[model samples]
Target: MQATRTEEKTAETHGGASSPQPQQRLRDKKVGDLIAGKKRLVEVPYTASLADTINTLVANRIMAVAVAAPPGQWIGAGGSMILESDKQTGAVRKHYIGMVTMLDVLAHIAGNDVAPAVEGGGGGGGELERKMQVPVSTIIGHCLESLSLWTLNYNTSILDCMEVFSKGIHRALVPVDGHLENVGGVELMESASSYHMVTQMDLIKFLKVHEAELRGILTRRVRELGGLTDIVFGVTDKTNVIDAIKCMNSASLHAVPIVESTDEIGDDHGQLVNGKDRKLVGTFSATDLRGCPISQLQSCLHMNIVDFLEKLLDTPQQEACGLRTSTREHITCQPESLLREVVDKAINSHVHRVWVVDGRGLLAGLVSLADIIRMMRVWMLSEPA
Candidate 1:
C-alpha cells in the first residue's frame, strides 16, 4: 500500500543531482601526479592482433598496455616487451605510444577503431587523422570528463595509486617523470603459480595452520576455499548518510571499508592491526553490513556499525570473523549453498563479504562474486590482474 518504497525512491532520485551545486575550490591534478610507479605495465607490439592482445591482457585482468614497436619486431617477444635503440629516444618513444586497457579493448570491440580513424576516412573523418599523430603528452591530462583523461608521475605512493583507481573510470595514459619509457620492478605475474594457479592444497594448508590451535575446539574443517583479494569493499569515516550514496558508485566493489584516524583517538601506534606499519583503523565490509544506509540498517538489522566494522578490522584469516563476532549467531548456512551464495550475500545483504564457517564457529576464508567466478572450474573466463 506504500507503493513499494525502493521503486518510489528510485523514481524520485532518478534524473539528476539531489542537491544544489557548491562552488568548491578545485585541485589541479592529473593521473601523472598520482603515479605510484607500482602497477606492472606490459608493452605489446603496435601491430599485435586485437584478439591476441585482449586475450593476454584480459586473461591477467591487467589495466593497460604500452603499445610499442611494430608488427615485425614483436615476433620473438610474443606480445610481452619491447626494445629501444637510443638513450635520448626515451621521451620521444613514450609520447608516441598508446596504452591499451580492458576499457580500451572494449572500446576497440565496440568499433571505435583508432586505426581506421588515423588512416583517414572513418566516421569522425579528418579529425581522427589529425589526432592520430598528436603527441600523447599533449592529450595525457586533457580532462574533457567524457574522455576520462588523467596523468601520474613516477614517484607517487601506493595509497595515492589506490585513490586513483577508486575513481572508477578509464584513464587514457599515465606518464612518468624524467622521460623514462620502461619501468621495471612492478612484476604483474612471475610464473603460472605466481599468477592464477591456486589449488585446494593451498587452502587446506592455510586452514590447517590457522585453525591448528582450535583443532579440538571446533567441530569440522573446511577444505578447498579461496577467493580474489582485489575484490575488496569498505565504508568511509568521512561520509555521512548523504555522502554514502555518492561513494557507492565510486568503485567496482560492492562494499566500502569504514576507517577513522587512530591518531585522533590516541590509540597505540599499531597495537590492533597485526602490528602492521599502518595505523589500526576500523573497517566496514559489505559482508558485515550492506548497501543500506546506516539509519535504515539500524532500524531493521540486528547488529550495529561498530559491530560490523570490527569484523573486517580483525586479522585477515579464514575465520577472522570468529575472533570478534559469534559466527553461529549471525551467519546463516544452507548445506546446499553454491557459488551463488556469495553473490546473494552481496546483493541481498547489500554487502560484498561472505565467509565460510564450520559448525564450531571457527573461521574460514571470505568469499565474493569475484572469488566464486575465479574458482568456477567449468566456466570460460579470464584470470585476475
Candidate 2:
C-alpha cells in the first residue's frame, strides 16, 4: 500500500497540486475513519457456552469478541445504555460486559483444576466436555490480565486510540453513529447503537499505509528501539500440546515459541531457561486450535506440539481457520533487521508477532504488535508540538 499512489490519485481527482500535510492528516483522522465501512461488530451473548464462543471465534476468524449482557442489565452499570447490532434482528440493545480473547479460553482450559481432568484417563474427556458447556462468563475473569474491553467514542482521534492500545489493551469498542452523553465530563454512549471493533493490527496497518511519513522511525534497527522484550516464554518441540497451552496461560501469552529441547532440564513450571541458545523451530498459538472439534480437543491436546502443528497445517480446514500456509516455516527476523522489515513481515503475514533470532537462528527476543505500536507512540509524542 503506497501512500504516494493514494495521494497521486487524490490529486488527480481534485486537480490540486498540494494537500494537507501527512502528519496533520493523520492527526485529523478519527476512530470512525478507521472503521468507516467495516462489518458490524460480532458479539456473543454472556450466556453462550464456552464451546459456542469458540465456534463464534473460529467461524469469524477473530482472536477476540465482545461479550454482551441482555437488555435492561445495564441499569446499574454506571454508564449509558450501549447497544450492539444483531445480524438476525436489527438494533438490539445490550450491555457489553467485556471482551474475551482466545488466550482467555486457553487460560481457562489450562487452569490447574481443568488440566488434570483433561490429562487424566477415562472420565477426563467427559469432564472436559462438561467444562466446555459452561457459560463463557466464567472465563471473563481470565481477561483481567489483558484488561477489559474499553469503550471509545467514534469521534475520538486515531492518536488517542493509539494511546489506549499502547497501554497493552488489545481491542476497544468504538460506538458509531450513536448519541453521546457527558457523564462527569466523560463522553459516554447515550443509546443503543452499532460499533466497530478496533484492534492493534488496525493501527499497524494504518501505519503501514502511511509508511512514507514514518521513514525516520521505520529505517531504524529493532535494537535501537527500547521496548523489545528480551525475556521470552516458550516451549520445546517435545512438549505436549497441553503443556504448551499451560505455558501460554502461565505466562499470559497468546503464543509461545517452540525450540529444540536442550539436555539441561528446565524447572517444573515448563519455562525454558537459557533462552539465547534455544533454536527457533515453530510457534504454538491459541488460534492453532481453531476449527478443532470439542470432541477431539482432548486428543489434540495430548499430541506432541510439533506433530500437532504439522497436522494442523496439513488439514483442509486450516485455511478456513486463518492459519497461514507458511506456518510450517518459521517467520522470523534478527535484531539487526530494520523496523520496517519487521512491520512489513507482520502485516503481510497476518501474524501478531515476529520472533527475533540471532545469526545462528537461535531465539534472541521477540517483537510484538504492542511493541511496534509503542514505538510509534513514542515517536509521535517526540514530534514537534
lDDT of 1 by residue, 1-385 (tens): 4756655565567554444344321111222333323354455555566545544553443434455553233221122222222344432232223444433332222223222222233443443334333332222212222232233333333223333332333332333232333332122111110011111222222223333332322232113233423223333333332233223323323233333434445532112211122221343322232222222222222233444344434434214222222222233232224444444444443333454443543222345433432343212112221
Candidate 2: the clashing residue pairs are none
Judged by TM-score, which candidate is best? 2
User: All candidates' lDDT scores?
Assistant: 0.33, 0.74
Q: What tens digits encode model 2's per-residue C-alpha lDDT throughout 1-385?
A: 6988888887886677647444455656777778777898898988999999998998898989878897765431224455665645666757776678888887877775443333456547777788788898767758344344456776777777777777777776676764443211123343345677878898899878877867878999999887577887678877887787877776677877887875676434355444555888888778787756676777777777888877676566677777763335887898889999999999887888899999998888889998998898788678775
Q: Quote the lDDT for 89 in model 2.
A: 62
Stretches > 4 Å off in candidate 2: 1-24, 72-92, 112-123, 145-147, 178-192, 265-269, 272-274, 325-327
After superposition on all CA atoms, what RMSD does each candidate show versus the true structure? Answer: 25.2, 5.8
* Winner by lDDT: 2
